[model samples]
Target: MPAEKKAYPLRISPAVLEAMQRWADDDLRSVNAQIEYVLREALRKSGRLKPGQAAPVADDQDDST
Candidate 1:
């Protein structure tokens, strides 16, 4: 079965949003999926993700720490 989709609310500048939209179209993904894919790649590159592990959730409380 396919995995469930999760919705995340984020604030970004219009320029960034535009860029993401273009990128998403180029990659044949929705804007939301592109963002998730980027985050997953970043986490993996930063050594914060193990092989086959899921991406970590970014909690609102995390900003305060």
Candidate 2:
């Protein structure tokens, strides 16, 4: 079973938060989920995450943009 979520209070500037909100909306995810997604990607890119430790991020082969 997956571990339960632990709540952590975050303090972010209004401008940054608003930007994240807009990006979250565009990605069809809630602001909180978008934040998690962004952080996870960063960790993966920096090689901090172990291979196979987390499920993979899907690639879109059909993306034309």
Score every model by TM-score. 0.73, 0.74
lDDT of 2 by residue, 1-65 (tens): 44345467889999999999899789867677777779888888899976666653332321211
* Residue 22 miss distance in model 1 (angstroms): 0.4
> In candidate 2, which residue pairs get closer than 3 Å at backbone N, Cα or C atoms, i.e. clash?
none
Residue-by-residue lDDT tens digits, candidate 1, 1-65: 34445556699999998999899789767777677779888889999977788743433222221
Flag regions of model 1 displaced more than 4 Å.
55-65
Using alpha carbons, what is the TM-score of model 1?
0.73
Against the reference, the lDDT scores of all candidates come to: 0.69, 0.69
Relative to the true structure, candidate 2 reaches a TM of: 0.74
Clashes of each: 0, 0
Where does candidate 2 stray beyond 4 Å? Answer: 55-65
